[model samples]
Target: MECCAFCPTESRELYKCPKCDRLYCSLKCYRNEKHWICSESFYKDQVKEHKPELMENEPQPEDSSSKNFNPEMFEDYMKTFKKDTRSEKEKNPQIRVRADEDILFDSDDEPDYVRVVAEKSLEEFEKIDMNDLDRKLTMAGLGGLTDNDEQLEYLYSQLNDEEKKMFNRLADNLQYDEMGLMNSVFGKNLPKKK
Candidate 1:
């Protein structure tokens, strides 16, 4: 919800200045002198803070004869640090590709091969008879094992009116997350899944 730092009017669309790290709503605000008064000051402060004497030098190549010559064999084996990562323009050059207008066009729909196969598969599943499906379930050793809440609902549907009232009453009394207390109607040890 933070607005652009340059303008009085609120706006979500903001561009962060690379040098000063300040937000501006538009390119016009980016170039505005009133908004950029401290940018030069920031840059100057940065340079002053990072003076020549304070700068840390990159590790110089060790002399083989120097007494402090720790065996850099481990370092070389691990490649722990990059001795020289700068001057990267001299390393790999950039790749450039020209934009082609002819290659840019929108399709109304995707190529329908996946869609057709999915539809046919769904139709085949729908065509399966319940008796065959039940037989498959029995063969798979899942005849007694019902699916989650859906099978619980199906089991509830098979109860008579009076039994359903008792079931609803018990269900209402029991907490789903933590059944802290056993329902007295169902006795002290309730039928709980192992």
Candidate 2:
């Protein structure tokens, strides 16, 4: 029988913390201050997992040329963003206005799943306020560390002034690397029509 990782006792029945894979004898042990960081992270991951699937596998247009952009197809795909339950979007939407950029630039070779993830990450990244410490941590996917003051302080302590400033400036603005993204996936940039 393995002992609980948080409590100093051998346990016949132990549950593993989903985030860290640490054994704990009970909910109390799992929720203890010593284990709260991992527990909190596990909760956040659970919330994300429970969200509805963001996008359906909709068919792409038969034409491969960027000039053949279809507004109806883009509208249908934008509907997938409506699946998000986040209220911030409802209050102040940062919706992309046109199919001119993202949809038109999407490389034919890129998988749908990759494009979906990239779009979601960009939308979420744009919503972040870089000046806020908690939001910054969340944007960095270290939101769970917000609950642990000691860990957060230690993490900051590890960074020198210049690195700290640079980290703080992440996502200060969004710029699409259109040619770079398309070139990497398509092996050449598609020429923009004059």
Candidate 3:
């Protein structure tokens, strides 16, 4: 383990802050340290020194440009902005609520019928079985398929005992036909088998 930069006496057991590269022993120490506090004179001085360009490039309000801006263009811009904001908020609903509060604080108070329906849907989703090919394709994502046989062999070798058994079963069922196996695993049509 690395030693803490601030306090050499302490072990670097905590994660280093990506922004400052400072090692903290714990979240409490990170928050309580004089360097961490926003009100600290040294902290303010460091921020100003390190990010002088940011202060210099602060956006100035459009003085006369806003007056001359077309109403139609402004409407269109507002529409686009609203749509993007709505989508973003939908994706992260917790942002609209207070960070300290729970979003599903009353989840326990939900109706028994609603709870049953939700549980049933979750159970159905969990029951879906994935074949070996399906598993590989899912893991591959947009990378499509591996071209290197050695990489594929290495990946196969890395599988645990149970996974190895599954792979062997899949290969046996596939009859060692690479093209057919690829197609079956990815649920795509195979090219003409040579």
lDDT of 2 by residue, 1-194 (tens): 99998779897888987678889898899888787667666775666678525323433444436543434444653543435455543544555545353332345546886889889999998997765867766789777454578787878899999988776654232222433443355645665222
Off by over 4 Å in 1: 1-110, 144-194
Model 2: colliding residue pairs: none
lDDT of 3 by residue, 10-106 (tens): 6635667665777767655555544343224345577679988666754434354564433344354354332433544477766667656545545
Task: Kindly list the per-residue Cα lDDT of model 1 for residues 124-176, writing each as its tens digit.
Answer: 99999888888888798677345678667777888999999888766666663
TM-scores vs. true structure, each candidate: 0.23, 0.25, 0.21
Of candidate 2, the 10-residue stretch with the lowest lDDT total is: 171-180
Span of 10 residues, lowest total lDDT, candidate 3 = 76-85
Compute the lDDT of residue 162 as modeled in candidate 1. Answer: 100
Model 2 has an lDDT value of 0.64
Cα lDDT computed for each candidate against the true fold:
0.62, 0.64, 0.59
Clashing pairs in 3: none
Number of the top TM-score candidate: 2
Deviation from native of the Cα of residue 149 in model 3, angstroms: 18
**Residue-pair clashes per candidate, as listed?**
0, 0, 0
